[model samples]
Target chain A: MAAALTRRRFLGCGGVLLVGACTGGTGPAAPTSSAPPPPPDPLLALLEEREGLLAAYEATGTAHPDLIGRVQPLQSQTAEHVTALRLALALPTATSTSSAGSSSTPASKGGSTSGPAVPADPAAALAELRSAVQASGSAAESVCVSTTAERAPLVGSLAAASACHALMLS
Target chain B: MDPTDALQEALAAEHAVIWGYGVVGAAAADNILDRVRAAEQVHRARRSDTAARLHEAGAAPVEPEAAYELPFDVVDPPTALQLAVELESGCAAAWRYVLGQTDDAELRGVALAALTACAVQATRWRRTAGISPATVAFPGQ
Candidate 1:
């Protein structure tokens, strides 16, 4: 009981010291507008792009079998981000319409879509996908570096996938 | 006046991203094909939503072009991956900037989403390129 009390006392004193060390600017020049804090990193923009790319790929349904499996898992992971964003923005949550079942997709049946399998040119399809995978992997790595609490698994996995893409392409 | 202006900027970014995806998707490998395309679609929808919201608010949306200049030479898969990382990393900075200018919750929401999306894309591209993308700089410099 005495040890517990001592720990509490220490924590209380530490808290005061920590607060003393912190500094808040004074004077009219320093404006801390209550705008919801700006995002610490810029990687979310890339993730948004990836969401579109992933959807386009799924729409094509021509992804390699292994890719198909890998993407589905990644899609699930991305949904967490989708939820976090909605909460942060105080926006309504998107309904899941992605044939992928990850988020609310605005796509209609008639819209023309593109994917890795559809290759703009069939002969160069593998080469193209390999390049894209590598690119996607690199993009994912940057994301990990930029933010504190976003998409680590997906980023790391993408990096690995890019390597795999090169092998598959070869 | 409202968050829509910032939203429009984000839409513009999405347009550019979709364009980049087109180039990379054209040559993405078989295994990662689905992921590449799926991510593109997400951006398209986000852009569309932002555009609509801007239009509703009487904001002029920035139109995306058929193509944009690549940051690096994409002669091969590895090279392309490196370029993709740089491209998305650049994009992340733009969105982060937008997030800073707006205080509207809706804008913040989209900004958060966009930021997260860019971060993920950067990570994937970095991993694919076999480089460590400074994961330590969370929240970014």
Candidate 2:
């Protein structure tokens, strides 16, 4: 949980890069400096988190076929979230990458891998999902506090959805 | 875009929701009436507080409509629950707009709480309506 909170802290503090509209400049651009720009925007990071969640849903569903009926809809909704986030960020949707190459990691740990390992046990998989949803929701709310007003509601809704998902999983 | 504008909109939504719940409770079975009453009370309190906030800010909050257009006929328990879901969803959307209009932590906190409550209420109503998943990717998108 601490790690997850830290990830949220990173997202909230590093959100200025997401919109890139705050640059005040009436004069010519300054000479390029050696200093690197801020790391990738946390909005992108949240999108990647959603991607990982989609993978988790798919993997868990595949591992437990009996749960497919309940899992497919969630997978579809998570896909929609990723699409919406991508559109909000003005990024083109990319084709699915290599899931096989991805590794299982909790969202709080910030693993770039897409695949999140699901426990073979159905109950345990649900537990994992609850935790992930809670963490992702927290991350979304953190981003909400820093983004533009137009975009904050988008993230806020994501957080609410995450909370709802956690309830369903429970 | 001002907070008052959003607050007024939220107050309007709360009014509609409180009015809608009256019809909803009438159509709901005995077991569901408790839930309806609870929801109505919550919205009513919220409406009062919102109006107070608006008045404090020197903005005149809009009055509730004499009646709101029902999305559908509330003829049974299922329909009542569905109406409840719609009403809460409306509240969620309105509060979300409020969130977009303010950066003040106190106001933001209020908006966030209201939005979250409405979303959760929608989920509960969906469950009562026998909707699977009972949740959405976005509540007010």
Top of the candidates by TM-score: 2
For all predicted structures, in order, the TM-scores are: 0.45, 0.82
Q: Output the lDDT of residue A39, model 1.
A: 54
lDDT of 2 at A65: 95
Residue-level error in angstroms, candidate 2, position A85 = 1.2
DockQ of 1: 0.02
Per-candidate clash tally: 84, 0
Docking level for model 2: medium
Lowest summed lDDT window (length 10), candidate 2 chain B: B103-112
Encode model 2's per-residue lDDT on A16-130: one tens digit a residue: 4433334654454343233665776678778877877887888888889998887777778888898898898787766373432332233335554435677888999989987
Off by over 4 Å in 1: A1-170, B133-136, B139-141
True contacts kept of 2: 0.67
